[model samples]
Target chain A: MYRYDEFDQAFVAERVTQFRDQVARRLAGELNEEQFKPLRLQNGVYLQLHAYMLRVAIPYGTLSAHQMRKLAHIARTYDKGYGHFTTRQNIQFNWPRLDDVPAILEELAEVEMHAIQTSGNCIRNVTADHFAGVAADEAADPRPYAEILRQWSSLHPEFLFLPRKFKIAVTGAAHDRAAIQFHDIGYEVKRNEAGELGFAVYIGGGQGRTPMVAKKIRDFLPEEDLLAYSEAILRVYNLHGRRDNKYKARIKILVFETGADVLKEEIEAEFTKIRASALRLPADEIRRIEAYFAPPAYAIALPGEAALAAARQADPGFDRWVASNVTGHRAAGHSIVTISLKPIGAPPGDATADQMDAVADIAARYSHDEIRVSHEQNLVLPHVATADLRSVFDALVTAGLATANAGLITDIIACPGLDYCALATARSIPVAQRISERFAETARQADIGDVKIKISGCINACGHHHAGHIGILGLEKKGEEVYQITLGGSGDETASIGDIVGRGFASDDIVDAVETIVDTYLERREGADESFLAAYRRLGATPFKKALYGAA
Target chain B: MANETARLWKDGGFRPNPWQDWPEDGALEPLDPGTDALVPLERFVADPDVFLARKGRLGVRVAAGEDVAVLAEHLENIALIALEFPSFADGRNYSAARLLRERLGYDGEIRAVGDVLSDQIALMRRCGIDAFLVTHGPTRAALQGGRIPEVRHYYQPVSGPEIEIPAGSRPWARQPAA
Candidate 1:
């Protein structure tokens, strides 16, 4: 996590005072609703469907134990005792009073966390792979670059009033756990033939009404040019992006209308003009930033157990958690652990105040004080000792954060939807809850095998349905909520937008429709090793479509 | 530099209103335009004595009779700088005020003028303005809409002069962002 210096600290504190005065002015009716709207948004406060929702940026999904504790404190004092982690890896506290929000922001500034750019038409929170530093296959930790971007974009005068909100994601490894393909700008860190590090840049990928996979504009962009190139892309979009229709304002729509080839040419020409200017990342400076994100040092030795047979024999529960929750790490004797916030039948990403404290304690205890919010809306203990896995698992279990179902069906990704979001035409969390309840049995989930189901309430796809192995998109037709299922979408190394499965399902029938598809996969899978995505790829949506509609 | 402890300027900036400084009717005689000589911003570097002597003193209060931009352009030569902010968030004056202080490096009074409100006094101070000409009263609004709450802020830098980022890794830009 990037620590705030005096400048960063004082800026936020001053902003708090500024916001407090703005609120006073608004209350006095000196500032009208129109005048107050943008200020509130820049501060990350929104008047949602139910109450004012404050979305706090967990910059690039990273949080210190202190920051997490502060969030937990806010959750307990001001908001409902729970906070919802978003797909972009930020957290939202629903039901916050507008008047109390400035005070909450003041406390947040004390811990070097604020809600700037969490909403409105501006550069948003940057995202990256949850297991960046700890991933065994990582080329480099992506968060340093992400932090740099966060600083550069925060309240940038040139970009504050963009045509639409922009999202950027970076992946440190070959696997795209960050859902890089679904963001407007995606950076894949990979080594070139000469072993120099660089990025494979993708542009215009988004998951709104027009969900499109970003086209690769630059095959290899050196790491230093990240900001300048990103600026160029944004500059082009800021100037030329359509403002006529709100739905048509995203860069994805522009890319679609202008054609990828033409867009690429324009971006390249812009890049050339700006590449050598102050924006290019000089090697020494990049190395300076890179130093901040260097992997935490571990005991210079491999894990005693190359095999997990001993752990399995010692404790069955720990064994199960290790099998499911433990992931590969780049450092020896270290393993990445995912503490599933999505406990069976609970909200997909809701972590209570106490649960937050407990997760922070465990992260500081087993790993460094470092924790990451996953795009799956879960929390990651990035560098836990393999030996301390048992202790970490026990602590997690007590917090109700332990769920040995990382890629299982019950670990569904869902947005707040109509339950909270004003833009949602339908509900997603309820659908997710229904499915989780349907498959509450651990044995049933284990049998399903690496199944991923993502649901979005509306076209925004905040739940990332477009990338789900079993994607469910909610829609409204004739004032009735309907769901359209898509098959074969995956948010991994091999990413693709799912194909729409046939006709839509009524709101009441959506749960059953999803169940029918899952049951179909279970019955028809060729072998035990074939994962849901592979099985769906082989069988196609036709069979699942037929399974649900009874005719295809 | 807002939140000046002396608390002299009630408005957000250093624009000390003549009404506040003296009597309510403390008015100055309006001056007519001299000639076609545009005030050069570099007078502080050119013969400072000559520029100062030539420009003389500017009026504490600006009227429709005087050109604010011309005085603003020669802020370096002028002993006093008073900028009128019609209303907070009507940030048009923020640019003009910032130019007077930052671009011309004016060290004298940089006050907020016209339609001044006291509530924005701290904010005006932060933007590097020195004083304000305000409508005395509670900086409260027309209606008691409600209280606005506070949370903590994460970042430190706002668009200003003091904490210039000295931004690293310049990008290739054919045009400075419009």
Candidate 2:
């Protein structure tokens, strides 16, 4: 929702020109692959298994209709007419040539977007709750603070090449939709007892080969000291994080190696010295950023409960979609609508060019010309009128974007596994597709209730399988793709990594194993009212393990 | 060997390095008085008084993982602080350079020595590193020619003069005057 001013415009324009020169140098053999690798990565270009994948940043998961249209245009012109939305709330174009990258960047710049920091060991795209301003339980819209961090960390001179890539996520609501606990640094916007705003800072949390839920480093850091405190954390990590082993290079390992108390002392010392510097965000600047995220003008009216109920009675499909996809909004007469990108048997987050265009059109018409990409691999119309829900659903259905499974068994989050990623040891998309097809019936998925199935192709956990209700991690055991199942992981306010059930199953047996686990939950649940996550919490992984592999 | 032709970039141009530097061959020794000697921090810390007594320009070569805070008290006396990169991916020195400039307010020459590639030159410069001890021929040529591609506008405030946003304009839109 934030518009680019002239300075921001020129900054991105110049970056495009700079990247264009880099590409030219690479093509002319003036720079080798080793020399060009970091440069290309900083601009979001990756040398994947099949082709160069360019990931474009959607800062704070916010997009305008015009920007969505431009993304569709890019997918149509440069890529293979489709783009995959990643778990970081960014989108990836899997097929873009080296030469076309600069052109693609130029187009992205026109729409106030770029691929900067989407890859490489720099401060990555700052993410926040997708329902930041619109959510009912929000303390403050976290986007303002997230945008401040975006500006502060972009091409940060001191942190350009950290020991490893750094990820920062912010969440405004008490619900924690941003998965704050799994990031390198997570900020939960909080208000003190005196009613002054600040942040509850968590550090040293990440999921890769090693998974860690972030530990709280500061109970309450004043909002004004945000950048300075962040600098302190980064400075400590940059100066001390391991550089010898790439696997142990993350800040999480540093916090683990040197106890959290020692790390906190170091961070506090650094913060003391730098807290009064110019990096401390000014009040006017905070207010200026907050103005950009103010709620859209809404028609004051009662909730559209009667009309929604009548429509649901008329069409069970619409009723099911409303039940799963619609979420409460802060403003009356408006609801947050999630358009499921995880359609049956398709890649978890892939949206065709036509689908993107249709969503853009729907946003322009039914919503307030704004779109949001959810970390669960879905697009959100944050301010859809409750009356327009059916119309929007109809348009989405026509464009193949309608899937009545949000937060249901069929709605899955999966990484680009062996199909595209060079780091993948096993295939992830096919596994997600198989599970989706196995539970394609809407009634069955609704009956099963909210069970998140997340899959990752490797240990990197890019698919965030560690946070799934039923987590599946694909590994190569003696040249065979084996699926390891974990149960009872959740990424909400009460964040916890899932535990592995037992020995992994072969790829052929994974789908049936998942079904058995789901059926096990259905039988073991207190009632249909209790979700899979809640049931798993009540009954630990023992029953699920027994269901997957026979009782030991 | 290419090391013989290694050029030093300082004060916006390349020049032959005046200071004599030791090879990073895992050895430490006292300073040689006739020529400027850059010794490892451990060597210098073993006998700071001996290094201080030398009647020549003194410098210290710090590895990426070394605690740079040890050099804080000696910032005013040291002529150069050479930060090693070990590998281009190891970016600890970038933080070290900023600490020297911003935290310690050390204004003397800060040279990026090892694995100083062309792509990182602009970044190193922005972090208050004013010099480079470059061995790669093409990288040296690019530095000498001022051909390292860089964006003029910056989003973050660093160790340089803050470009004031024009009054009545959005602060983020302000760019450094051409």
lDDT of 2 by residue, A176-266 (tens): 9999988899999999999999999999888888998888989899999999899999999988888778899999999999998999999
Shift of residue A391 alpha carbon in model 2, Å: 1.1
RMSD of every candidate to native, in Å, equals 9.3, 2.1
How large a fraction of the reference contact set does each model reproduce? 0.11, 0.75
lDDT (Cα, tens digit) per residue for candidate 2, span B1-178: 3355447777777676777775455547633576788988887887788778888888998988887789888888899999998778888889888888887889888888878778788778878888888666668888878888667666656674333343223233234454
TM-score of 2: 0.97
For candidate 1, what is the interface RMSD?
A: 8.4
Report the lDDT tens digits of candidate 1 across residue range A1-552.
577766567667777887888887788886778667877888888888888889999988988888899999999999889899988899999988888988999999989998888887878999999988777788888888888788767655445556688999999888788878777899998888988888999888888788888888887888877887887787677656776687898888889999989988878887786676556667876676677777676877755464456867887667767877889777777788998888877889999999999988987888788898998888999888887887788888888877888878889999888888899989988889888888877777778879889999998888889888988998899999899998888877677899998878898898888889889998999877988899988888778877887773
Docking class of 2: medium
Q: Please state the CAPRI-style docking class of candidate 1.
A: incorrect
Which candidate achieves the best lDDT against the true structure? 2
Clashing pairs in 2: A7-B173
All DockQ scores: 0.08, 0.61
